[model samples]
Target: MRALTGTGVLTRLALRRDRLRLPLWVVGLAALFASIGNSISGLYETDAARLENAQVRADNVVTRAFTGPAPGSSTGALTVSEGLVFTCVLVALMNILLVVRHTRQNEELGRTELVGSAAVGRHAQLTAALLVAGLANVLLIVLSTLALIGMGLPAGGSALAGLALGTVGLAFAGLTAVAAQLTESARAATGLGGLVLATTFLLRAAGDAFGNTASDDITVNPAWPSWISPLGWGQQLRPYGESRVWPLALLLLCSALSVLLAVRLSVHRDVGTGMLPARRGAVRASSAMLKPIGLVWRLQRGLVLGWMVGIAVFGAVFGGIGDQVDDLFSSEKSAQFVRDLGGEGDLVNAYFAGMMGLLAVVVSGFTVQALIRLRSDEENGPTEAVLATSVSRAHWLLAHTLIALLGTALVLAVLGLSTGLAYGAVSNDLTAALGDLLETTLAQLAPTAVLAGFALAAFGLLPRLAATVTWAAFAVCLVIGQFGTLLNLPDGLLDISPYSHLPNMPAESLTVMPIVVMVVLAGALTAVGVAGFRRRSLALGG
Candidate 1:
C-alpha cells in the first residue's frame, strides 16, 4: 500500500510539469485531424463523388497499405480512413514520450532519486506517469470527438473514432511502462518501445494492404496479423462501418496486462537500474572522442542511421505508389483534392511534390531532435567536461549544429536516390526519374535549412529553452505546411512558418530567387545562434 502512497501527489506534480507540453500535443493533433476532415468533406461533397473516391481507394493498393479500408460509405468514413492511422501513430508517440519522460528519463536525470528520498513508494512514480498519460489520452478523445461533431459527423461514430485513437494510445502507454522497466537509460527504453511500435505498425499496414475486400467501396477485412497488434485492433473497430465496439476490449486488455507486468517488474529492479543488465563499455575512450564533431557524430550516428533507413524505405514505397496513382486523378474532384494537398500542374507531379514537401517536414523533425542534443549534453554534465578541454563554446555548439545540417542532406539524398530508383524502375525511365526526384528533393534543402537555423537559434539564445522552442517551432511549421491550406487557417498565421516559403517542386516551376533568399535567412539565423551561444557561460541559464 505504501508503494503507491504518493501517487496522488506525484500525479499532480507530473501534470504541473507537463502542462504546456501535453496541451500542445493534444491541441495540434485534434486540430490537424479536424482540418483534414474539413478538407475531405470539401473534396467529396457529392454522393457520387464520394462513391467514386471510395472505389478509387478500394482499387489503390497504396492507399489501402497506408490507411486501410474505409469504414463506411460516408464522408466521415473517408475521413476515418485517411486520418485514423495517422492519429493512432501520433497518439502512441505522445504516450510513449509521456511515460518514458516521467519514468525512465526522470530516473536517468536523478529526479527519481530525489523523489525516492521522501515518502514515495516504489511504484508511485510509474503509477503517476501512467495516470497522466491516461488523462492526456482522455483529453484527446474528447476534443477529437467534438471536432468531428462540429464538422457535422454523426456523434456516435465520431465518439467511436476518438475512442479508437485514445485506446491505442493507452495500450502503448502501458507497453512503454514495461519498456522503461527493461532498459537502463531513457534512450534505450525509448528505442525498445519505438521498435515495438514500428513492428506492430508494419504488421497492421501489411495486414490491411493484403486483406480481403469485405464489400465493394467499403471495409477491407484485415488478416490475422492485424489481430495481434494494438494498432491493428484499433483499425478493426470498424467505427463507421460495422460500428463494432468489441475491438476496444482487446486494446484495453493489452493495456491492463502490460501495466500489471510493469508493476510486477518494478519490484525486481532498483531505481536507476533496469531488469536487463546494462552493457559495460570499454576502458579507453575512442580516438573519435578527441574531436568535437567526431564526438557529436558518435553520439548522433545511431539516430542519423535510423532516420536515413526509415526515410529511404518510405520513399521507395511511395515512389512505387506514385507511378501507379497517375491514372487515379481522372476525376476532377480527385484532381482538386490532390491539388489542394499536393500542388498544381500534372496531378501525379503534384503528388510527388506533395510527398517531397511532407518528407522535408519529417526530416526537420530529425533536425530539431538533433539540435536539441546540445541541451541533453549540457544536462548530463558532459558539455562542461568537453569544453574544459580546448573545445571552444562555439566549436562544441557548431559541431552538433553542423552534424544536424549535414545529416539533413544525407537523409534527403537517401530519400531522393531511393525514391528515384523505385519510380524509375517502375516507369522504365531511370534517367529522367532520377534527375527530377533528385532535384526536387534538393530544393527542399532551403526549407530544411531555415528550420535547422531556427532550432539552432533556440539553442544559442535560450539555453534553458532550446528543446521546447525547437520542438514547438517545428510542430507549428509541420501543422501549417501540411494542413493549413486545407483548414483555411489565416495566411498570416500560415506564413509565420518557414515551410510556407518552401517551393512545391515539379508541380510548380523552380525559382532561384526564393531559394537564395531562404538560404540567406538561414545563414543569418545560424550566425545569430552561434554568436549568442559563444557569449554565454556553460552554466548560463540555470
Candidate 2:
C-alpha cells in the first residue's frame, strides 16, 4: 500500500467528527468581523467626520500600539482595518489550537494507531487533519465576505478583507503543523504555537506604532516594517484603499512552504515521538512534590506566574494610557462623555476602575481553568490513584481550589499595584494613587470569587460537563459586563454579572454586603462540589 493510502477515507471521518466545532468557529469569526463592520459604518456615517476622528485617535501612540496603523483615506476603512486585523489574529489562534489538537495529539493518545491498523495509511491521518483545517479556513473566508458585503461594504473590498483573515488562519495552521511535529506533548505544542502567535502580534504592534507617520502630509508614508509581519501584510492590502490582492498570494505561498516542511518532518519522526526528543528528568521526585498541596503548587506555579506577569504588563499599559485621557478630553464634548460614563468621579480613576473590571474577568478565566484541572485529572483516572493513597478527597479538592482562589487574588493584587505605580509615576501622586488602585483591586475579589464558586459548583454537580459549563457561564458574564452598556441591555439582565453588584471601585465607596454575599455563594458552591465528588463514581472520559 502507498504511504498515503486511505487518505480520502480519513478525511471524510475527520470531517464527520468535527462537524459542529468547525462551523461554529467559522460562523462566530465571520459574525464578529461583520458586526464590527456594521458598527463602524453606522458610527462614522460621514467621510469628513471619520477622517477627523481617525487623525486624532489613530495618532495616539497607545491606540496605535493596540490597533495597527490606520488603513485608508476615510475613517470607516481605518476602523474596519484596525478591528479586522486583531479579529483575524484571534481566529488564526483558534484554528491553530484546534487543528494541532486533532492531528498530533490524537495520534499521541493511540487513537490513530487503531485507525492505522484498520487499513489507514501513514499519511492518511495527517492529510485528514490538514483537510479539515483547510476547509474550515475556506468557510471562514466565504462567511466573512458575505457578512461584510451584507453589511454594505464594497463586495470586492470585502472579499479581499475576508481572504486576508483566512490567510492568517492558514499560515498559523501550517505553523502549528510544524510545531506538532517538533513537540512530543500536546501541551508543549500548543504553548509553542501560542508563543509564535504572541510574537507575531508584538512584532506587528511595534511595526505599526513606530513605522507610521501621524501627520496629515500626503508625501510621507508609513515604514515598511509592517510588510514583514503576516498581520502587517494583511493590513497593507488596504482593504478599501488601493486594495492589493498580492498579499494574499504571499500568505498562501508561505503556507504551502510550511506544509511541505511539516510533511518532510513527519516522514522521519516515529509515531508518538517528536522531532525534538523529550529530555530526561531527575529520577526522584522533588522535595516540593511530597504533599498533595505542594504538588498542586508545583504543577500550577508556571501557569500562575505567567498569568501574574501578563496581568502586571496589562495593568501598566492601561495605567500609562491614563495620562493621555486628559489630553484626549480636550474636547468639552468628550469630557462630558467621560463624565457620563463614570458619574462625577475623576476621569482617570474611572478609566482605571473599568480596566480593573476587565482584568477581573480575565483573572476569573484563570481561576476557572485552575478549578477545572481537578475535573480533568479525575476523568483521566489519575485522581483514582491519588485518592487510593493517604490523601482524602477533601484534601485533593482543597489543594486545587485553594490554588485557584489564592492565585487569582495574587494576580489581581499585582495588577493593581503595577497599574497604580505606573499611573502614579506619570501623574506625580504615587502614594495616593497606589492606595486607591489597590483598594479597587481588592474590591474586585468579591465578584471574582463568585465566578470561581460557579466553576467549582459546576465541577461538583456535572463532572462530565464541568469545563464546558464553567466556560459558558464565564462567557455570559463577560458579555453582560462588557457589552451591556453599548447594547443597552436591561439593568436586570446586566445585573446577572456579579461585578454589576459591586460598587465601581476607586470611583465609588466600598460596601460590605455584596462582598459578604459573594463569599457565601463561593463557599456554598465549593462545599457542594466536594460533597458531590465524594459520592459520584470517577468518570474516565466524555
Candidate 3:
C-alpha cells in the first residue's frame, strides 16, 4: 500500500488521456455484438433453421475449431458460440494496448521518468493502467449487456456473456502488465503479449475442436487444455447453458496472481529500464539504411511480417472451410440457411465473396498502423532530427505512405494465395481457386489504398488527432461495411466505407469501373495529405 502512492491520480490521468479513445472502443464493440446478434437471429428465424444449421456445423472439424461449441440452440447461444472467441480476442487486444500504452509507452517516451520526480511509487503507473483497463472492461460489459437486452436476448445470458468477455479482458490486462516488465520497447512488449494470446488461442482451439459432445451433438465439454486458458474459461462459463460462476473465479484468480507477479517484478528495474536489456543498433549503416523506403521497412517490417503470417493462417482456415457446404446442406431446412445469408444459387461463390470483404477489412488495419507510424515518429524525437538534415518531410511521408500501401497489397496477396491453396486442395480445382482468389484480393487493393490515403491525409493535416481519427474511421467503416446490411442500415451509410466499392468478384461479373474510380480517389486524397503535411510545421508532443 505504501508503494502505491499517487495511483488514484495516475488512474484519472490515464482515463483523461484516453477519454475519447476508450469510449469509442467500448461503444463500437457493443454495437458490433448487437449487429451480430441481430444478424444471427434474422438468419435463423425458425427453430428448424437453427437446429439444422447447428447439425450441419456440429460434425465439421473446421467449424468446431473456429467457433467452438454451441451452448444452446437459441439465437443468443449461437451468437456466443460463433462470436465468443472473436469478441474475446478483440477485448484482449484492447486491454493489451491499454496496458502497454500506459506502462511501456510512457516509459519509452520518458514520461514515466518525468512523473517519477513526484512522490509516485514505482508500481503506481502499472497499477493505474490496470485499473483503467478494468474500468474500460466494466463499461464494455455494461454496454454490451444492454445492447443484447435491447436486441431482446435474455437478461441473464446477456449479462453472463458480457461478464465472461470482461473477465478475459482483465486477465489479458494482467498478462500484459507482466509483458511490459519484460521488454524495454513497447512494440516488443506488445509482441510478447500477442505471442501469449496466440498460444492461449491455439490451446483453446484444440480443446474445443477435440471436445466431447453430448448426444444432442450441439453441446460440448472441452478437453483439459481449455481449463488453463483464460479464453477457454469464457466459453466454459456457458452463458447460454449453465451460466457458471466458477470460471470467473479462475479468471480473477489467475489475473490477481499475474498482477502480483508484475508488481514484484516492477521493484527489480529502474524507471527507464526493463527486466530485459534494450537492443543496441549496429555501429555502421548499410546501403539500404540510406534509402527512406528501406528505413521505413526496417522499422515496420515486423508489423508487416506479423500481419502476413496471421492473414495466411486465417486465409487457410477460411478457405478450407469453403467446400464443406456438402455437409451444410443436409436438408431442405438447412439450404434455406444459405439463402438467408443473401447467397445466390451458388453458395461457394457467395461465401468466397463475403470472406474477401472481411479479409480486406482485416488487412486494412495494418495499412492504418503503417501510416500512423509517421505521426508517432514525429511525436517522438526522430522526425525533427531527420528533418534537421536534408531529408524533406515529403520524402519521409512518402516512404511511410508507400510502405503502407505496398505492404497492404503484399499481405492481401498472401491472404489470397493461402486461401486459394487451402480452398483449391479441398475443391480439387487448384488453378481456378488460385486465379480467382488472387484476382479478387488484388481488386481490393484499390479500396485498401483509399483507406491508406485517408489515414495519411489525417496524419498530415491533423497530427495530434491522426491516430484517433484513423482508428475511428476504421471502426466506423468496419461496422458499416461488415454488418450494415444485417443491421438494416441504409446504403447511403454503408457506401461511406471504401470497402463498399469493392467489385462483386466470383459472385458476379467484374465491375472494373468501381475499382478504377477508387484508385483515382485514393491518389487525390494522398496528394491532399502530402500537401497539407508539407505546409504544416511539426507539432511535436501535441
Which candidate has the highest lDDT of all? 1
Q: Which parts of model 3 have CA positions greater than 4 angstroms off?
A: 280-283, 326-345, 540-542
Predictions ranked by TM-score, top down?
1, 3, 2
> C-alpha displacement of 221 in model 2, angstroms?
5.2
Candidate 2, which segments miss by more than 4 Å at Cα? 42-48, 73-75, 214-225, 326-346, 540-542
> lDDT per residue, candidate 3, 155-234, as tens digits?
99999999988999999999999999999889999999999998898889888878887899778778898888899998
The numbered model that scores best in TM-score is 1
Give candidate 1 misplaced runs (Cα > 4 Å): 215-217, 282-284, 324-330, 482-495
Model 3 scores a C-alpha lDDT of 0.84
**Ranked candidates, highest lDDT first:** 1, 3, 2
Residue 20, candidate 1: C-alpha displacement in angstroms: 0.9
**2 versus 3: better lDDT goes to:** 3
Q: Rate the local accuracy (lDDT) of all candidates.
A: 0.85, 0.76, 0.84
Candidate 1 local lDDT, 1-542, one digit each (tens): 99998999999999999989899899888887887788788767787777666677767776777777787768888888888888898899999999999999999999999999999999999999999999999999999999999999889988999999899999999999999999999999988888898888888988887888765756688888888989899988777677889999999999999999999999998889999998898899899888999989988998999899889878987787776664645567767767887787788788888888888888888888888888778868579899888888888878988898889889999989998898888889889888888888888888888988887787788988888778878878887887788668999988887777766777877888878988998999999888888877665652
